[model samples]
Each structure stands twice: as C-alpha cells, then as structure tokens.
Target: MKTALFELADQVLFQNYGKRDLALVRGEGVYLYDDQGKRYLDFTAGIAVCNLGHAHPGVTDVIERQARQLLHVSNLFLIEGQVALAEKLTQLAQRGGEAYRAMFVNTGTEANEGALKLARRYQYVNGHAEKTRVVALPNSFHGRTMGSLSVTSNPKYREGMTPLVPGFEVAETYEQAVEMLDDRTAACIVEVVQGEAGVRPVDEDLLRRLAARAKELGALLIVDEVQTGVGRTGRFFGYEHFGLSPDIITMAKGLGNGIPVGAILAKQKVADAFTPGLHGSTFGGNPFAMAVANYVVEVVRDPGFLERVRQVGEALRTVLEAHFERVTGLGLMWGFDVEDAASWRKRAAERGLLVTVCGPKRIRLVPPLILEEAHVQEFEAIVTQMSRA
Candidate 1:
C-alpha cells in the first residue's frame, strides 16, 4: 500500500515538498504508525503543530462533535464557535491590559498577511499614509505569500519570486533596525524565535529597545509567533518572555492542535484600523476549526499545563546536552549544532526516531508540548548509541 501510494503521489502531487519515505497511517500520544504498522516515536509532532500530541482525545472529541454539528459558514454569517474562540483568545492575550481583538485565518502565512495589512491600514487611516515601509530582521521566515515573503529576509525563498513587494527592508542588526524605523516605516515584524533559521531566540534587551523605537517612530510592532505561540515555548505567547506589548501578534501552528487555524491578536486601538471591508477570509474562522482551537486554548492556557511544559523542556535540553554540544532554543523548541545534521537525521529516522534539520548544520527538535520524560529518555538512548557508533 505504501509503495503504491508513493507511486501515485509521484505522478499526481506537486513536486514542491521533499517528503520522507515513511507513509504514516495513524497516530496516538507521541507515536505514529506507518503502513505495515511499524511504530515510531514521533518527535517532530508534525513540525510542532500537534502540541497536545497526535490524536489528542480532547481535541479529537471536539472535532468530531463539531464536524457532526457544523463545519463551515462564510464570514457573512455569524459563527458561534468563531465568536467564542475569538473571545477566548482576546481574554488570554490581554495580560491584564486593554482589550484585544482577533482576526482568524486559515494558516500562519495568512495570519502574517493579515497582520501586515492591519499595520499598513492603521498607519494610513491615522494620517501617516507615508508610513508604508516595513522592516524585518535578517534570517527571518515570515511566510510564502507575496506579502509575507516581501518581509522575509532569506534570499533562497525570494530568489525567483521577484519583482517582489516593494517597501520591504531587512535590518541585519539592532543599529540597522533603529535606522530603518523612520517616519516612512509602517511596521516591524519579527519572530520571538526564528524557527526556520535554526531556532534562534532574540535577546530581550534588543527586543525591548526595538519596540520602544518602533513606537517612538509611529511604527507598529508585530511579533510573529506562528511557531512559538500556544504554549510551545512554555508561554501562551512567545513575546511574553520579552516583556513586549506589541501592536500585533500573529499565531497558528498549535492553535488547533491539528486543525487548520491561525489568528492575529491586535490591540483594540490598532484593530480599529480595519473597518468593514478592509480584509476578509472565506474560510478563516469556520466553525470546525474554531471548535478545535477553543479546546486547544483551554488546555494550553492552564497554569499547570504551561509549568509542565517548562519542566519537560528543561529535561529534554539537559538530556540532549549530555549527548551533543551547542544546543540552542527554549522550551520544546530546541536545535543542536551538529557536524552533519542531514546524515544524523537520516540515521535517527532509520533507528525509529524522527527529527528535522534546519539551516545548514542545525538539527531542530520541535516535539509536541505533551512530551514526557520517558520520550526524552528514549531519544537519549538513541543518541547515546549513535555517539558510540
């Protein structure tokens, strides 16, 4: 069955993704079963999307119930699940401050695209129409869409996509960022941790300074939490670690545990920039996605759950450091500076362990937030054996 599927995929599917040889059929807590029922402890968690682990009963129950009830309703009509999910997100994101508003989308890229639009619209409506330029950091990965891609600094992703969107600038250093934020700068978007760029976390002081400068220059600060949000970094949102009050926060990956859901949490003041018809998504906040996301948020927002994430993350790091050198990242999002990342990843897969490579020599591990010490120990045993080999 797996071989036939592979042959069919080769003929029918687009040749964009470099997928692994394994064709997984089912999943349960921290594990996946491929065709022929070979079990592998899943460490990637579908690239950190399954925070509660694959087929989480809580999330699955809601999905099944919601699917039986109502799946989708266009934005024209009011959706109960959509409104409830948005209210919950705003409540969690407020952090004891002013009210926040949420605009749901279908993916991380869409959330970022919405954020960019929100920032530019806010500047335009406030009579700062000249503030149309956007500033982003080098080694940033925003999205693949034209709008988000414009602000993404990696040349490989943008090589053939030009002539890309204009008014996008890349700042290589804090000094460069300060100079880039002028009267013409509408927004500055950055990831709290550059996930695709090898799980690098930005310095807190630099982040605070950048936020201050953007505010002083009348530019909106947008934090892209697509990978670090929803308790992936032991925080409801990654910006919390940096003490930032950003104008816009975008998220997606783990919001629905597996369901496709993305959102932009904007301060009420900035959210007012988007009026009736400024932006809209046909399937953004549909009922089924909202239902699953609501359950996910309820689980992730718990104090005990977040604390456990911190503990588990620290343990994972400790175990990895004992086996490898130069480990980087926070919480479940970790990367190891290895000598041969690709070959190491291939061997680990062969040994029934799954991991991924980032940048050139960084092996990234963005396991599910529901990971246990036992899972980490299993991975450790594999690494220890590899070290001897």
Candidate 2:
C-alpha cells in the first residue's frame, strides 16, 4: 500500500516536496501509525498544524458536526461561523478592548498577502501614497506566494523566482532596519521567532526599537506570527511576549488545529483600508474551517491550557539541554543544534520518532500542544539512546 501510494503520488502530485518513505495511515493523540502499523511519536505535529494533537476529540467532533451541516459558501454571504471566529480572534488579539478586525484566509501565506495589501492600502488611503517600500529581516520565512516571497530573505527559495515584487528590502542590521523605515516604507514584516531559519527567537530589544521606529516613521509594523501564534509561544500571539501592539498581525499554523484556517488581525484604522472590492478570498472564511477554528481558539486561549504549554516547554528544554549541545526556542517550539541534522533526522525516524531538520544543522521540535510529560520522556529516551550510539 505504501509503495502504491508513493507511485500514485509521483504520477499525480506535483514534484515539489521531498517525499518521505513512510506513509501514515492513522493518528491518535501524539502518535502516528504508518501503513505497516508502526507507531511513531509525532514531534513535527504536521509542521505545527495539529496543535491539539492528531484527531483530537474536540477538533474531530467540530469537523464532523460542521461537515454534516455546511462546508463552503462564497464570501458574499454572511457566515455565522466565520463571524464567530473573527470575533473570538479580535477579542484575543486585543485584550485591552482596542478596536480590531479580522480577515480570514485559508493559509498562512494568504494571511500574509492580505496583511501586505492592508499595509499598502492603509498607507495609500492615509495620504502616504509613496509609502510602498517593505522591510523584512534577513532569515525570515513568510510564505511561498510571490507577494510574501518577495519579503522572504532566503536566497534558496528566492533564487529562481527573481524580479520579485519591487520595493522589498532586506534589513541586514538593526540600524539598517531603522533606516529602511523611512517615509517611503509601507510596512516592516517580521516573525517573532524565525521558524524555518532554525527556530531562533527575535531579539526583544531590536524588535521593540523597530516597532517604535516604524510607528514614528508612519510605517505599519506587521508581525508575521504564522508559526509563533496560536499559543505556540505560550501566548495567544507571540508579539505579546515582546510587548508589541502591531498595526497588523498574521497567523495560520495551529489556528484550526489541522483545519486550514488563517487570518490577519489588524487595528481598526488599518483594517478599514481594505474596502469590499479591494481584497477578497473565494473560500477564505468557509463555515467548516471557521467552525473548527472557533473551537481551537476557545481551547488555545484558555489561561490554564497556555500555562500548561509553558510548563511543558520548560521541562522539554531542560531535558534537551542535558543531551544536546545547544537548544533555543519558546513554549513548545524548539530547535537543537546537531552535528549532522539530516543524518540525525534519518536515525531518529528509524527509531520511531518524527522530526524536521532546518537550516544546516538544527533539528526543530514543534510538537502538539496536547503533548504530555510522558511524551517528552519518551523523546528524551530516544535522544539518550541515539547519543550513546
């Protein structure tokens, strides 16, 4: 069955991803069962999408119930689920009762695209028509779309996709970032934690300074919290840790706990820039995705659940620090430096563990929020055995 699936995939699917050998058949909690019935600890958590764990009862129930009711409806009509999710997101994003609005999409990249458009439009309508320049950090990953890719700094991803949308500049230093936020700057986008660049957290001081500078220069500060939001960084939004109140914030991974849902929460002034005909997504806030995301937001926003994530993160870091040479991350999002990450990942997979290698020599662990102490212990045992070997 695995071979057949692989063959079919090769024939029918795009050859974009580096296909893995094993074909997963089922999942329960933190474990995945392959076609041959082998249980593997899922540390990757579907690239951090399954925050509540695979087939979580609550998420599954929502999906099943919503599927039976309604799935997709064009964005022209009013959607109860979409409105509910947006209201929940706005409330969570702005705790101080600040006016905020949400625009939903189907993926992180779409959310970012929406954010970029919002920033540009805000600046344009607010009499800064020349503010079309965008600043991005050097090692940031926003998304794969052309608009988002233009701001992403990875040379590998941007190699062949040249002549990118103009007015995008990469800030090599904090000072450069300040200079880049001049009068022509539309927005400066940054990730709270650089996920694909090896899970490195952003410098708090630099971020704070940038925020101030952007505000002072009349450029919007766009926080790309696609990987760091949704309680992944022990906060409803990662920017909260840095005490930032960004003009626009983008989020996606884990927002639906496996359901495809992404959104951009923005201050009312900025959000209002996007008029009805200016920006729209055909299936952005579909009922099915919104229903699941509403449930995910309720569970992830709970104070107790977020606190548990913090505790588990600290415990996992302690265990990893004792074994690995270097560890870095916040909450459940972590990465460790290794001698040969690719080889290490292969060996770890052989031992029934799923992990992803980033950069050149870092292995990232973005496990489900439902991960327990026992799961961390099991991972520790695997690492200990591998270290000994």
Candidate 3:
C-alpha cells in the first residue's frame, strides 16, 4: 500500500528533487514516523530548517497562536511583530561589532537577493554605480533564485539557467578573489563553510584577507550565513568563528523554526543604500512570520542552548570522524566524507534514520540543537554499523 502511494507521488510531483519514497505523517523531537507507524531518527532536521526540532511544543504553540491571530499582511503598515523581530535580530548582530540593521524577507534565496541588491545600491548611493561586479567563491551554495543563482558557483545547478545575472564571477582562492576585485567590484560574498559544496570550511586567514581587501577596494564584505547561522555553528553567526565583522550578513533557514523567513543584516551606513521605495515585497516582514521568528530567536538566543549544541556537535563529530575519512563543521552543522553518501542515505533510511547527502560522498548531519547525547549516539551507531556492512 505504501509502495503504491510512493509510486503515485513520483508520477505526480515534479522530478526536480531527488526525494525518498518514505512518506512522513508526523514528527516529534528528533524523530519522524511514516503512515505505518515506522519511526526514523531525524538527523537532517528538515535540511537544517527545523532547528528547534520537529513540532517543538514552544515553537508549535507560538505558530498556532500567531496563525490564529494573523497570518500575513502587506509591508505598507508598521507591523508590531516585524518591528520586534528586527529589534531582536539587530541585537544578535551587534554581538561582535556595531548594531546592524535587518531587512526581512521569505527564504534564504530572498535574503541573498536583498543582500545583493543592497550591495549594488550601496555603491550607487555612495556615488559608485559603475562598481557592480560581485565576487563569490567556487562550489558555494546560496540558494536557487535567479539573483542568488547568479552568484552560486556550481555549474551543475546553474547550467540550465543560462545568461545568469551579470556582474558575478567565481573566485577559488584568496589570490583569485583579490584579482577579481577592481574598481567595478561592489562586494565579495562567501560562505564561511560551503554547506552544499560538502561542508568545506574556508580558511580563516583567507577570510581575514578577503575582509581586508574588501575594505581596501571599498567594497562591502557579505557573509552568506544562511546555513551556518542561528547557533548552528556554535555561534549566532558563522563570522564569529573568525573574529571578523562582515559589512553585510544574509540569513534564513532556522530563523523562524520552520516558518519561511529570511533577513539581511547590514552595517548602518551600507544599510542606508536602499531608500524607502527602492525595493519591497508584499509578504516580507508579515506579522505571523515575524512573530514566529521572534519566538525562534528567543529560544536559540539562550546562552546555554548554543553551548549544548557545541558539546553535542563535538561528540557527534568525534564519533563520525572515527568511521569516516573526514568530519567537519561547527556546532550542529556537521558533515562527513563517507565512501558513498547515496547508498548510505538509502541504507540509513531503511534502518529508520533520516540523513542528507551534499555531494556523491559528503553526508550532511544537521540535527536539531535541542537533540540530546542519546540521539547523537543512536545516529552514530546507525551510521557506524551501516558503514561497516
């Protein structure tokens, strides 16, 4: 019966995504169940979107309350939830350097879109419209939207989307990035750890140099922390790992604890690039999204919450590295270089576990931060036993 339903879904749905055959009906902390009551340990955390875990009581309660009150509204009016969320995010960004402003949107891609626009607008507003070129690293994943796709370096993802938005170039090394920068370059954006590119962490020195060069070239340094932010990397933002301040920081995924939300945190001066009517979104900063995001922020912002993430992440990494060739990343955003991620994913799923693959060999492990050591041990044991087989 379940197999027939899977077949029906495969025929009906678009073939763009490589989806598994399992159909999840319900989820709880660190676990998901199919229609037949077959349970699976949810290590992927819905691809890092459900940070507080599936159906967390607090998050679900907030969502239910807010949904009943107000679901969405246009950006014309001054919404209370939007204002409160912005204030909370602004306070988070101010942890290392100055307090940066935030622009709310509806996904990681939208966040990147706003960041790209702000970069161009900054150059224009600062009397340098000719400086429109943006430099991004190779094998980086921002999102799938056209504007974000333009900066993404994976040819496989961007192949069909030809004639990509211009003024974008790929930089492999620090030297390559430096050469790409010129009078026409408006910003250099890079992910501290390339998530989809197989959990590769960029060199700290390279990031420091890139920040310095961006300053020298008078271009903004945009850090795309969409996958690594909000306590996933043991810190509020991935940039905190390197002890550097980015001029612009784009975020999503886990911001609203599964409610679609995105934001751009920028330095006050550069943030002023967009005037009131320069750009807008109808559903951006809607009341319901903001209210849910506020609750998500409140939960993740607790000091002890992130500290536990670090401790559990390290334990998971140590266990994984013992079996796999390499395991890397910070906090709960972990990945390992297994011999074959696809096969392992299938096997793990069959054994009642959920995981994700980054490449042919990279197994991404982004579980909920609230997960305990027992859950980590179960994940480790499952993958370890499968690898040996």
Q: What is the C-alpha lDDT of each candidate?
A: 0.89, 0.90, 0.86
lDDT of 3 by residue, 154-263 (tens): 88888878898899778776578877888899999999988898787889988898888889989999999899988888888888898778899999898987888888
Residue-wise C-alpha lDDT for candidate 1, range 1-389, written one tens digit per residue: 35888988888899888655888899999998888788888889889899999888888789889889998878999888878888888887887987999989999999999999899999999998899999998788999999999988888888889987789888887568767888899999999899898888988888888899999998999999999999989988988888898889899989988888999999999999999999999999999998899899999999999999999999999997887777878889998888889888888887888888886788999989998899989988888888888
Q: Where is the poorest 10-residue window by lDDT in model 3?
A: 170-179
Which of candidates 1 and 2 reaches a greater lDDT? Answer: 2
Backbone Cα, N, C clashes tallied per candidate: 0, 0, 0
TM-scores, one per candidate:
0.98, 0.98, 0.97
Report the error of model 1 at residue 47, Å. Answer: 0.9
Q: Over 4 Å off in model 2, which ranges?
A: none
RMSD of each candidate relative to the true structure:
1.3, 1.3, 1.4
Q: Roughly what TM-score does model 2 have, to 2 decimal places?
A: 0.98
Task: Give the Cα error of residue 356 in candidate 2, in Å.
Answer: 0.9
